[model samples]
Target: MSNLPENSFFESLKAEDLSGVAYKNHLLKKKVLNYFSNFGNSTIQDLSKALNISTPKMGQIILELTENGVVQDYGKVDSSVGRRPNQYGLNASSAFFVGIEVKKEYINLGLTDFKNQLLKFLPHIPYNLDNTEEALDELCKIINQQIDKFNVPKSKIIGIGINLSGRINYKTGYSYSYFNFSENPLSKVFRTKTGFPTFLENDSRAMAFGEFKGGGIVKEEKNVLFINVGYGIGMGIMINGELVYGKSGFSGEIGHIPLFENEIICHCGKKGCLETEASGRALISKFYKKLQEGSQSTLSHRIKSENDLKLNDIINAALNDDVLAIELIDEIGKKLGRGISALLHLYNPELVIIGGSLAKTGDYLFLPIKMAINKYSLSLVSNDSKIVLSELGEKAGALGACQLVRKRLLQSE
Candidate 1:
């Protein structure tokens, strides 16, 4: 179906190379956009070398693409000894994909092109995790409205990527948590409800993909591990530049690891799980219990009821140096760090990223995390992994969902 010229060498893409529906027939155009999508900004000479064509021929194709609004002038790059060459980039308007990250409190929506350019963003849309139909109804409404506003045909949107917290079987696309959707695969339900091809992934794994490619760090490294600390702690492991989902897609359940021997129970019915002692939910519960036991604080008056308390409230309290809040967070950090050290011993990744809501606590969390790693991690691999905070903030999961569709469309396998 390619619009490639009769003499063109580019043939049909292999069947295994496609995950979602193909959008266009311009093989050369697809290749050009794929090049920019993978390598970011580049000059005509660079495209020529990748495509194995003369610069003049590349220029001619680029001129056609620019005139059609598919390519744009990125800017001029100064040459070492001559006139500067113009750099080119993909026009953001040419195509787009949908990414959605579902949290218990709200949902984040994003739109991006093949170049991984985020054309629009929407955050903090209220959603109730208990009612799947109501949530899906509202989600479709929002996505349809955005597509109409952008004037892109639904057919051109390669897919919609869904990232959520839960035990997800990627092959079956069912979750053992949040909406659990036993009647059909969650992605199938989403696809049927929205009329877009759908891909589903764990939230932490999705964020790892986004940071790996869209965060602009994929080029220099081949191994990474992302530890997401939120309502629960989850791990996303990447080895040799590819994400490892493990057998049955439930590999990174770090929160369920029995790191403590205490009597506390986890929501998953496991006793003494890491999440029972270290998760954000655990932090808030511990803080509230202390308050109930007559511990005084400046926050006591502000929080008239337990219903008004949230993880953000505790983090804000800590930022203001509330002694009680700091103590609780430090405890959570130590428990979290113990789990991280276990990962360090098992994976030996080059970089370990701390992401999700708690990552915003900055050094308050890292100090304890590093201390625990130093005390328990094997010296051979602990020093090899560099632990740092995620720069993508709360949007990491949403953007990572977008990366799923982009990678699928381009077949980055």
Candidate 2:
């Protein structure tokens, strides 16, 4: 394999191929890279102390990383005393990770550097998402096209993370909800077609990871629940600072929770799922029904047909203080809050983040959720959880996908 960090130290590459010493060194190098990724620039002594390695050994690893163009010298740290220690950090150009979010109506693509900083984000690429072979093919084609247009070489693209909805076993690289036409894993197909190491993640989990690492949560907040109120409601649960993936890696199916009494059948073919009333799809359905009932809204004419309407249009309308838009969002929020009350009773998370497309409605959505939580949940449990909107908003899923690639790559065996 090439000595470049992009090619040599990928997660797909087997560490068993390396000798014991080489494997240990590889593990240490990965630790160093992750340190730089999390803490940004650091002095050699600081790295040695934090990573629990001797200064000389740390120096050796740093030297190897620098030689491989993975770590770059960032001159000396500021100090009052003479002979300040030199700072080192990841070479931003060393490798790139791509994150792709496949939504019901469109795709979001993003690129992150070795430091896990988003370098580019392509939102709203028109594509229909479905559980069909042709849909998967078109998705792969769009991903490849987007990557090709990026100002990075194919070899330098170390990994790709594709986020999809429904039951996805990220470890097994299988998407149970979509692209299950063949026995082959969805990620395997993507890897073959995209010519890169690819991994599949649940969209809600990806969004939660994005918020956990990039946008939301302080260092103190470890337990979090990210409620993804997208086309369908999904959840990403974090407990004790680690994302919770159940035995089958299908942990966060909060949307399908049987919380309502309505006869509306969910996309999952169940009746009275939380998603039947508390999701973006639900929001659109309610808006259309209300419009047909002669409810007035400034956006009614703009949405002549169901196909012409979009989640964003409603969110934007709510943001502009449209009454009907706000009312429907509040209704969704109340139902979502009731569902979240159940989660709070179970998880007692330190934080609950409202994310996805509906998050754009802001206080129009947040206040009702807060009210509902207060009304439904026990004060002690609900009080511990801070309900807030997502800081990353629409970008969370794609950005989290990129973060997941780096995370899986550096995970110790």
Candidate 3:
């Protein structure tokens, strides 16, 4: 029932159906594959030391893996006084995964191999989110184009992983906030249309998986939180090393939480939401509101229309000591801190990650956040959690989706 198998081998195959010999073979093969993936072209001793097993044992696993075509020999590495040992690596080209990030205005598609290398990525393909059928058609078209561009056999692709904006039910594969399909679930429809197995996840949850697997400081830490401040605000929670999906699979909708009792309505049919105050949209809105009132700003000449205004314009201006830009970002950071304070008191997470576009502002954004949290939250709770900016930028959701596909494939195998 566990999604992340720490040992890598225990969940490789079905326990009830596997004989002793068969299960042992599966375990060794999985171990060898995992070792080779982490260290490309590793020798028997290299794998042995990493896995804390004997060289002979590693050699046995490598031989079995190589014979079964899961691994391939990469010549020999000299052992100084001793004879050379053959190095091995996974058959990276044997399997491929497709990950898609779907948004209101655009979609991003990425392809990764068994080695978890992002081989190809197509960014910002425009589409309309409200039209379910048209959206599905566009998705299929883009996927086919990429598949043709890569010239990959359809059979070799393991599965397609999709991460989208909105609330999703893990059990039923339905997104309540978007893609209100009347006939079938998005996953089922996508799978039927594409003729490939598919997995769907909340965009924030997918991004958190990317951080959990590589980006954030979650190594050996159990509780973590990933807050995405893109055009809008979103959050993903990880507790006890597992992504939290509450009863309805919608636990981390922090942006919609009404932090202030104002008339500013949110897109989610709510008033005074945190996102309306602290999100990138809010930042832009605030800046424009001041500009319209004839407020002096260095960005006035550079920005032609509201369309030309982006977060980077504000961030660059702030970095150049522009008081207005810095002030706006600082205000947003304080709001973010308030939201984070609530999370700290509730979850008491070990690490909290700020990701997405606004996170690119780095310390300018973080300093104010730290100050706000310190002022609002209990020292005991705030001191326990360390907040850091996410290393993975826009690629988090797509990469995490592909990684999830790889994980499912490994468990099924």
Measured by TM-score, the strongest candidate is: 2
**Candidate 2 to truth, TM:** 0.91
Cα lDDT listed for each candidate: 0.78, 0.87, 0.78
Candidate 2 residue runs with Cα over 4 Å from true position: 1-16, 77-84, 215-219, 298-309
User: What would the per-residue lDDT of candidate 2 be over residues 259-304, giving only the tens digit for each residue?
Assistant: 8899999989999999999998898898988898999998877778
**Candidate closer to the true structure by lDDT (higher is better), 1 or 3:** 3
RMSD of each: 5.6, 2.7, 6.2
RMSD of 3: 6.2
Per-residue CA lDDT of model 3 for 48-74, tens digit only, reads 888787888778887766765567898
lDDT over C-alpha atoms for residue 395 of model 2: 84
Taking all chains together, each candidate's TM-score versus the true structure is 0.80, 0.91, 0.76
Ranking by lDDT: 2, 3, 1
Worst 10 residues of 1 by lDDT: 2-11
Per residue, candidate 1 scores C-alpha lDDT tens digits across 311-367 of 878888888888898888888988898899999888888899898888888888878
Q: Runs in model 3 with CA error above 4 Å? A: 1-68, 71-90, 121-132, 215-218, 297-323
Candidates sorted by TM-score, descending order?
2, 1, 3
